[model samples]
Target: MISKWFDERLELQKFKDKFLNKAFPVHPTFLLGEVALFSFVTLVLSGIFLGLLYEPSTGKISLFGAMVPAAYASVVKIDLLPLGVIVRRIHHWSAMIMIASVIAHLARVYFTSAYRKPREINWLIGLGLLGITLGAAFTGYLLPYSQFSVTATSIAYYISKSVPWVGDWIARLLFAGEFPAHATVPRFFFLHVMVIPAVLVSLVGLHMLVLIKQKHTEPGANRKRKEARGGQRLIGIPVWPEQSYISVSLFFFLLFVVVLMATYIPLNPIETFGPPSPVTPVMRPDWYFLPIYGFLKLIPGDLSISIAGAKIGPEAIGGVFFPGILAFILVAIPFLDRASEAHNYIENPLHRPFMTSAGIAVAAFLFMTTVSGYIDVLHIAPASMAIYVVVVSAAAWVISYLLLRRYGRAVKKGEHVES
Candidate 1:
């Protein structure tokens, strides 16, 4: 009755037929994107709740029968509210899950060569999503306004200002007067709650629109369906009942798992960390940012280069150029690889030996840097850091070489050809 009523006035049936009956391929690897999408949705819902009780001010306020910084005090008050602790922790864990899921989904796209020609624009959009997500996380990281947050923010400020030419200007723009001051919190709060979220939400909508319009890529193994004039034939169930049920089930399952995490392991106990200060603490940044932080630490602070009377140090080397080069490489993948144009059809990684091996090598370096981030926090000796650097790098390249050799022989024998 309700459906008929709505359909009569709103013509809802046309929209339902357009999207609900759409074909959707069912594959575990393909589901990674859905995981990321649901995680972001969870983040948004929990974030709105947190924003209601959160204060962006750095001023002291009397709350819960005690005096404390406005940011910290509001958080404490929120925790006292119904399901407040669970909601806040859910937000934190949701961000972590969102980042990890996106990275894995991107890796799947890369190994399967799904980012070719028609998908290049999507690839760019995905990269933008990653940047916005990270920026949102970083800005949120500082909103706690704890001692640990202040310390990490100061280190980041120094790194920004360490660049030779425009470092100082960048740092000044980021924080108006100086580090650990009242001015910075509101700026971060604005970016975290308003600017970054707006951009991210818009991009995510556009990404979904593009995906729906272009149609999904299907596994080459499914040869039963004939190819369309411009795209591959997708053989799967309609989204109306089949795909929608699974997606909704997955969303609730994810929510359950996150709730369990929030119940068991609460994130960032603000009282223990205390308020913001100049004193450096033993704590580190969130795990996702650890690699970049570790990279900056690995370089010698004393190392410097003179450029027109300005002295730039190792921060620019490990912090600037290295990361910039890596980012450029990722963005340049479609143009650099001569065979990217042929990556339209989805195929198993075994079919692309060289590309697969090269990707593995890249993963190794990222893993090495991520572990390196924990050197100081974990109290590893400097000698061990040096040794691990050499060994991890060499081992990555060696493994890639071995994979290539084995696959090369297989290709020569005409054993496994890509569809």
Candidate 2:
């Protein structure tokens, strides 16, 4: 009766025809986006549970007969609650997995040339999602108000303040004055629990709508052959059974993995770190921020320039300028490699020499920089790390370009080339 009532009111048949019966690509790589979505769902559910028990403040509270920040004390209380540790661990791991999956999904889209033409808007949206995800993670990192978190997050505080003209303003606005201030925890908590999640949810909805509109980009020229023979209809499983089955299975699998990891592996024990202190510990940002940390370490302390009476320092260069340039390049890729017509077929990376080579170089650069982030522990010199990064990235670019060009020539000549 309820179904019939809704069907009559909402035109359920039309909705099913539009979405439920639509074609969905049956590829393993396509699951990356779903994994990210599932992870986000997990985050939201876990976050709500945590938030109900959390105290988002830096105010002092009596904890175990000692004074501690309310935020830190609340975290400790949550840890004592039944299944709270597991829930927190799941939340932490889900964030990590979500970020990783988004990155991998973007990489798959890039290497397969799925960002071509009409899908450019989705590409931009995906990048926006990535930024929002990072922002979420960064804000959440400070909510515990622990020594480690405070110290690590303070690096970000300084980095924000490293901007030339309005650096101080930005830092004051974001961090609520110097790091670990009374208002800092509340500000971060609001962003992490409310603002960022709201934006993330909206963007995710738009992303799915755009995705459904554009349809999935299929791999290789097989779809082209099918299109030529029949009509331009997509060849894939219907969303009703096959795709839904896979999606359901994948979500459960993700949940199982997250639960298993949460049970076994502990993440960021704030109790051990203690509350925010004047004695800052030697700490580092999470792995996602390692590249920026590495870049900051690579630059010399003395590197600075005065521009229009404003002093631009190494922190600004490495933290702000480097990332800004990379983001610009990524955003410009679709525009720079504009297609004459809408492209629904994915191109092999080896066939696109320049794009593939640039990807290789950038990957090399990121990997080296990530390694460089641990130079203090690794006992490596900054100059040596810089030289190594440059040499390896350049060599990777040149070699990959040359090899791909050779392969292209062989394919054009119709020669049998071994992989």
Candidate 3:
């Protein structure tokens, strides 16, 4: 009687029948997202561990009665704790993997044309994730308050201050005052720990949900065949064996990279510019952002506009506003390309070649600009005329190609085809 009552209450037979009949398929490339997920998981775990030992407050505190100096000393304590160094290394390495994996995933999607049709929103979400990743990295760099961090923050300050009307206001909001203040570290700590992570987690969830709903976009030809086959679900292997294998491989690879970087190319602690000082001109941002930094510096000082009794520099418009707009455009690409004939790169080369070439050209230009910035920072004055020539040549080439495409399209339509 008791057994029957329990079975009726729990619906045991239905549960067992459903559980025992589920099928699983193993797909090789599907493991890429798994690797990224693993890295994010590692980041969260390590972050929690670090938070427990970290004092986020900017208030003065003594460590072991030694009068540990504010933000720097707290990080030092994190280093000196048992297995603290390893934990920190793991956190840093996991962050690198997360960024790398996200880039790789996006590249895979682009090359495979997985962003076509019903999956466009997922593409936008992925772009959001990229932006969040960059924001997290930037804020994380400030947490350490080392020489590199200070230099990077100084560069950030200048860029922020270059904004049109609210630039100075934004800079003050970020740093909590002029330059380095007691509130700076705490603000960054709040952003890195709570705000950005929450947003990142939400976006990641949205991306995954959309991906699952749409299913993975197979190669276009394969998709056609599958449709012809009366919608038979393609087999995918279980997450255990296939995904586990790839995840393990990626873990070891990242481990090797972390060890190599930590041992051979340890993160440089900027010693020259002690603390945040405006007198020292030696300052530069992190490498990922150097391209934009160089662009700002390249803008001429004379390009200014007077509006509302305030003078605005071209650096404000071109460097900050233009780049920010470009970023928005990039995120909206899937929506902008409204063609339905074909979506894969090979099939729609004519439609997307300009976009593809433009992307490559922009990457090349940014890389060169970054190198120029580094040269300037190192006291080796870069040739301004040479840089200008390169920039103009690239812009001219892109413009010419676009005009040729426009004329070619008009001519093709003008001449009626014999069909």
Top candidate (lDDT): 2
lDDT for each residue of candidate 3 in 1-419, tens digit (9 for 90 to 100): 88788879998767656442332333344456666777777788888997777765545556566543356556777777786766777777777777767876776665445676767788888888988987888888777665567667766776678787788899899877766677778888899999999999999899877765555554335556666887766444333555456567877776666655545543434233333334545566656666676666655678788888656776676567756976887677777765575342223333344655565565566666666666555554445733763775487558756865886687677775632
Q: Please name the candidate that would achieve the greatest TM-score relative to the true structure.
A: 2
**Count of steric clashes across candidates, in order:** 0, 0, 4
Kindly list the per-residue Cα lDDT of model 1 for residues 1-419, writing each as its tens digit. 99999999999989998888888876679888889889989998999999988999889888656666899778877878888888999999999999999889889988888888678778889988988888888788888787877777787788778777888888888876577678898999888888898999899899989889888877775554444334455677899899999999999999999889999997888777877655666776788786676666677667788889877678787777767777788898866654534443576787676677778877877777778788876788655775787688768777876877787787877754552
- How much does candidate 1 score in TM-score? 0.91
Q: On a 0 to 100 scale, what is the lDDT of residue 385 in model 2?
A: 94
Q: What ranges in model 3 sit over 4 Å off?
A: 1-35, 57-68, 177-179, 224-232, 235-241, 248-260, 268-283, 307-310, 314-319, 341-352, 377-419
What C-alpha lDDT does candidate 2 achieve relative to the native structure? 0.91
Q: What order do candidates take by TM-score, descending?
A: 2, 1, 3
What is each predicted model's overall lDDT from 0 to 1?
A: 0.81, 0.91, 0.66
Q: Which regions of candidate 2 deviate over 4 angstroms?
A: 415-419
**For residues 1-419, what per-residue lDDT tens digits would candidate 2 score against the true structure?**
99899999999989888789888866668889999999999999999999999999788999999899888999999999999999999999999999999999989999888999999999999999999999999999988889988887888899899999999999999998887577888889999999999999999999999988888887676676686888777878999988899899999999999999999999899988898778976677778888888999999989999999788899999999989998998899899999999998888898999999999899899889899899999999999999999999999999999999999998977754443
Q: Please list the Cα RMSD from the true structure of every candidate, rounded to 1 decimal place.
A: 2.9, 1.9, 6.3
Error of 3 at 221 (Å): 5.1
- Could you tell me the lDDT of residue 135 within candidate 3? 83
Residue 400 lDDT in model 1?
74
Specify the poorest-scoring 10-residue window by lDDT in model 3. Answer: 342-351
